[model samples]
Target: MSASRPATTTAPARPAGPGGPGGRPGGGPPGMAAMAGPPQKALNFGPSAKRLLAQLRPERAAVALVFVLAVVSVGLNVVGPRLLGHGTDLIFQGVIGRQLPADVTKDQAVENLRADGQDTFADLVAGMNVVPGQGIDFGALQTVLLGVLALYVGASLFMWVQAYLLNTVVQRTVFRLRSDVEDKIHRLPLKYFDANARGDVLSRVTNDIDNVSQSLQQTMSQLLNSLLTVIGVLAMMVWISPLLALIALVTIPLSMLVTAVIAKRSQKQFVAQWAHTGALNGQIEEAYTGHALVKVFGRQREVEQSFGAKNDELYQASFGAQFVSGLIMPAMFFLGNLNYVAIAVVGGLRVASGSMSLGEVQAFVQYTRQFTQPLTQLASMANLLQSGVASAERVFELLDEPEQVPDAATPQTLDDQPRGRVEFEHVSFSYDPEQPLIEDLSLVAEPGRTVAIVGPTGAGKTTLVNLIMRFYELRGGRITIDGRDIAELSRDELRSSIGMVLQDTWLFGGTIRENLAYGDPTASEEQIRAAAEATYVDRFVHSLPDGYDTVIDEEGDNISAGEKQLLTIARAFLADPAILILDEATSSVDTRTEVLVQHAMAALRSDRTSFVIAHRLSTIRDADLILVMRDGAIVEQGTHTELLERRGAYFDLYNSQFAAPDVEEE
Candidate 1:
């Protein structure tokens, strides 16, 4: 099962181990970490967008609520400028209300009538009673100002509600996506992990998921409101005066053309920027994880130089991409200001001629601002949306990966008190089909027999154990326990029957007692203590100030390597399996601890089948049967003495280790 991440307010790089956020610890240019998503050009944007919509389908209700609130907000937003114009008209009307038409000249009436375009000369004269000394209508101004205030307040309230609902929708969608990623991690095969970096996998789970959350929070509301504001404001502008609406809208295409050209050119740079960012991140991770190796090899300068080169590439790409994206705002702003100037000139003529009222002309100018603002904002965030879509594509790719071969619908189990006789009949296996690692191999270990597999590197030592545990299925023949094929049994049943201790020790952060009882969670303290004593874990643990209660940190760094190995051995002992697989299980321990481990292993192997894989011949000398593998084939098989007498590959391998020390006598 994939481990559930602990809930935290801060979004870090990963789980278990993370060098630092962005790329490398204190490495890379400032603000480079903010660009963590995969490059946009590398992704299938059309499909990813469709899939993103599909991901949000379940939250349609919440989306609809947000959409409704956005519409209300934008509708109210469209009303603000119109009310301001109405207030202006109210002031104009107040001054005119006190005027008498007799005071105005005949030429003024004719000009007003011509500009009105629809009003008769008498109608225009009746409408405006211009007086030489008519004070402003204070009461009417207050009412219009109050109405404008109310409309703006209502719009702000709707905007808040829309933001709240948008947050809820984004959070839920991200939660479900994260849960899917977690579940997918477990279903993925070991081959998948082998092919990809653990850090990258974790980035998708932590950083990319967070990116999606933030993208929605930042982009969704802005996208929705901007689009709605554009539509509503355009409609209101056209309603007030088509001529001004046409002039204001003329900038849309020109602004779009400039934005589109710059965006197209920048998309590749954005992709390159993120790609190099990921590359720099990988380099940082490798250098950091192997920090000890680098120091021991005195390659600090080399590592720093390599990191610097990658960082410089990332810096260039990031700077170029951001610089291009930055162009949209100023470009849009310039065009918008030009459009605003054009509208003001045209609207003034119509207002003076009485072809349009003072209020309507004022409203038209505000609508022009509303119209271009959304376009400008959207243009600026195009890269962010692209980055998010790219991330979605990466996440979806993992979700859609081919899973491991599943278990049989009707799986079998080992019989009660079954003997542990094993057989590998004509089994052929390979990590890659083009390269055969193991072929036509056949062997058997009778009940209570200890089968030691001896081999050099790349000779399939670990691969053999993996096949038996059913971690990897056989490409050709099958193995059997007693008379039943192992494949017929569920992996859980097959694995549960076997106890394994690998060369690498894995102990979670916990007390000594907890690590000991890992293989058998229900084990009582006495059982845990007994397993620890058998594996000599109790011996050193007792020396610690906290005894069995001593807390070990991650990777068991607080404890000696030998101590960590002992805990794992103890864990296997507590499992009490019918079969055991020890892959150089005592390699890390010193000779003194090796003796203790051997004694415990000897007891545990009694009356049970055990597979011991080791390069050290001295350790497996007492085995009842020995299988010497060469290039994935068993070249020699017999008791240890027989193989030595044969004087073949096994003889050469054994003698190399057992050869007399070449150090000159001192």
Candidate 2:
């Protein structure tokens, strides 16, 4: 069999270069590295994180409500400890006051003790605020305890409400992000997909976006609450004692230093971890897609080795990221403990000196814990934020990809009566600007004619059809259908009028009837069956247990290749298009099935202009016109007999195929 060049935009492959990482043959799969796209090394945490937050703008009202709730909750929680400390002071005062003589005032008792050189005991009694005549004020203690209980309950309620609102905001923002990514994928030019790996793109759309969502869900509410707690607790500490507040402030710089150092190191590892994750996913997709080919070529060992290397790279990156980011919590905890000790010693001294009440000191101690706990939480969340931002950068990169050129501002429409007359005028194109593929290529396919394109490999036959379809913008000149420039017509309008079937069959996971209807969504059952019978798809479909209802798996491996080809042909026939393209459409079918499909194609070609790209010389013998291409140029053109008589490029190609098989070449 003779084959033409593949319709790929990549540069030609380099000869057996150094094996990639693990001594893989031909670099795993042809152009695997290119498919993986570019590696992301640098991370912009600040900008990406800000942009991620900006996704919540649409839910701004909800976010504001969450903020308010967090503040209220943290305020109530802060007030609770102060009130409980007051209750503690009350009980101590009651017990001490009861022991005093009923006739002696508290001041007199403290003065007498001081005169006796028991000043420490005197100061302790003064700090407790005991009245010599008072005893056990159970009523006041119960009221203070009730107030504390109410504050705690209110705080819990507000916290729960805040969390609920934050969850909604996060989910909504992620929903919009996913929708945006999905829309961006559709708008991106085909060149992007051709240049990048399917798995990597999928990772950004699936894994990366999912990571962003999870990160926001896990961190947003707690982060908000923690920050508010820090502020609220700090205020309470200052209210209790300025000196103790100053002592706690001493640890702020240390906490910042620890977070900055550890987070800086972990950020890079987080970036690497996600990058390697995308690379590994790309490899997995490629391997799974071509599992049969790998076995056939006996390159499984190379593939496995390549996989192992990528997997190990991901593992190391993930471990480094987790291990390094893990340091922030412990370091912050240590600083917090040191701050706690300082506050405790200073508050104790003040209490002993009778300069501060025991209740005030106890409350200040509680405030110190509250303050340090929030700082600890914020430090711990740094790692989560870093990973989330790394994933956000990737998703943003995709969303920022350049989109396909917009359709014509004023689109042209075809007449109700269709005539398929395709003309390529002074057309030029190339996969790479430096390496020209097709230049000054011109052709005319009259209505109701079968124009066969025959060429050796790399001769640009398929590229010609791609140009007609406007899959790639031409470097120069124009293509027209029925005297109207195809560029003027919207892509949708142009494509709706044309039908294409490639050698590689694509059938989505659906019943046979559903797949057939894909070519014409509005096509009736009768029309589908008619096309199927015409292309002989009905013959095999009926043999199945469910007939037309038989469901095809995702890979469509349940059916034979030839049967799949027949289904595609039937689909094209059902389209009833004005123009048709068959890029080696019959290559996969057996000889007998090929004959049946050819007859069906001949019937479909009536009154339609069809471009058939084929490798078999015998197939084009009956074509209305045959064009021979060589190195992206049309070298010969005419009827089969006329070309043979001319004894030109077509003659050489014909003899090469019919003559003693000179080691068949593509």
Candidate 3:
């Protein structure tokens, strides 16, 4: 599929070299098309916009209040220019009247003024002090100026109220929005997290919400004022002179056309930019996370070239969107100024012919400038709001994801107790349904028995344990804990009874004591120490400066892998689940540490049912029962001694690990 085609400002993809973008055979990155507009698209505000308004439903009252205030403020502001024009006209009348002959009768002056199309008597009073050379109304002009001052003060106050109310309302809305996103994250299933990148998800929660917050704060006030300004300015312009108003209105449609085309195109670029940015982050994350493997295989140069490709794509997309969107302001300004020049010329002609007063001409010119000011602002912010909407759509998309099914209406609970016995009956499952991985699989672990699962890679050893833990639901059968069906129990109740220590040990950022207590937070200090001692975690803790209080960094990277494994084992021991599964729990440790862990495992599993998925055959030699698996099903089952005597798949696997590669004669 062609990636993001730009709407208005299209840029061709960079020339492709070997292995094209991101070391893949494509003209550009897979999802990123060159920045171009779609051949066609309807100008509809989609569901994302509707959803945003719905989120703001609670603040409707405040928004309505802001609208009313905007009208009043704009009405007051609009009248000030006309009042200024009135004062200018009065001054012009006064100056012309002063130049009149002192000996001339007022009636003769009026007759001569009529010939010149001037208001003969409005700028003067026919009193004794109204001398031809002098009578000025300084005190009266000051009084009139105060009214304009009052209008401006009132408008400023009204705008202040609107800003205050709107800011509070916007923040409250974004707060709820952020809270909803956090809540949605928890409700999402493990499968969601597994499939989506953490960085992208975090971008929605952080970057997207910030965009919405900032845009809402700025756009709400700007939008309200712009709408009010445009309406009031249009009305005043038409009242002054409809012909001039019509001339000024020509810029409106032209400005809109430019804004719409550029907006549509920039919107596409914004979406493409974010997508390529995510791809770039993914590439960087993967390469950096696997830095050791890259160095081991000597693919650092290849990795750098691939990153360069992604970085270049990101740069092109970002530059295209920003450059195009940036044009809105200057484009609108040029158009607005062009309108100003046209109106000024036409108004000047009317004033010269005395069809319009000089004051009125100035007022019309001011109103024309006022009209375009709002259009320019609206045109500029349109792109910002569009970008915010794009971000919001991503967030809403996550919120709309299908969640895991709720537990049964009346869930069964273990009542703080459960037998270690587990049974899987005719269970069929697959990660991808079309590619069946497990078919009609069944296994039973009797109470206090240690069941060992041995298989080659892709043999579904981990899949079986996942089924038992109910991490993935069964497709065609029932898995039971003791005698009760696992589906009947709340997932929490069912999962709490089982403890897992996987090959990958996860330790959050906290102290060693805190991480160990994570499996069972209620564990007392004494109990915590016992579990740590049991798993030999205490010995390492004591060696550190802070003992059990030693802090672990992310994923416990501050500690050695062996120590992390030991901490996980201690945590599971502290949990003390009715059933335990140690899936390659001892794999990270050295031989000496392995002995310590194996000894702890034997003691911990003495009374509970346990399943051990192992690659090292020597460790599971004494398991009560051994299940040899191949191709997602059990191929053989017996005790270690019985399996060895049978000389089957288990025999070959056991010997393979201990067997040295044969030295062939040269």
TM-score of each: 0.87, 0.93, 0.87
Which candidate achieves the best lDDT against the true structure?
2
Q: What is the lDDT of residue 422 in candidate 2?
A: 85
Model 1 segments more than 4 A misplaced: 1-42, 97-140, 415-419, 482-484, 661-666
TM-score for candidate 2, please give it. Answer: 0.93
lDDT, candidate 3, at 46: 73
Q: Which candidate comes out best when scored by TM-score?
A: 2
Better of 1 and 2 by lDDT: 2
Compare candidates 2 and 3 on lDDT and give the better one. Answer: 2
CA displacement after TM-score superposition, residue 41 of candidate 1 (Å)? 5.9
Candidate 1 clashing pairs?
85-359, 99-129
Error of 2 at 314 (Å): 0.3
lDDT of 2 by residue, 1-666 (tens): 011211223222222121111112232213434856335566898899999988999998999999998899989999988998898889878877877776888889899879989899789888777888688788999999999999999999999988888888888899999999988887786667666777888999999999999899988987888888888888888888888899999998889888999999899899989988998999999999999999999999999998999999999999999999999998988898898888889888888888888788888889888898988988999988899999999999999898987788999998776698888777777655656666666677888889899877656677678778777778887899998998899998998888988877889999999999999999999999999999999999999999999999878999998889889888988999999888888888999888878887887788788899888988778888888876677777878998999999899888988988657678
**What are the per-residue Cα lDDT tens digits for candidate 3 across 1-666?**
011111111111222111111111222112332222221232233777788878888888987898888899999999999988877766765676577777776666656666666653422332212345544566666766888899999999998998998898899999999999998887776556555555566667887788889878888799889988999989998998999999998998999999988897787777766556556656776677678889999999999998898788879977987888999999999998889899889887676665678788888988988899999999989767777776777678788998766788998877566777888777776555555656666667788889898867656677678777766667788888878888888888987998988887778898998998999999999999999999999888999999988988865767899999999899999999999998888989999999888998999899888999898989998798888777666777888898889899999998899889799998
**CA lDDT of each prediction against the hidden true structure:** 0.76, 0.83, 0.77
Candidate 3 Cα RMSD (Å): 9.7
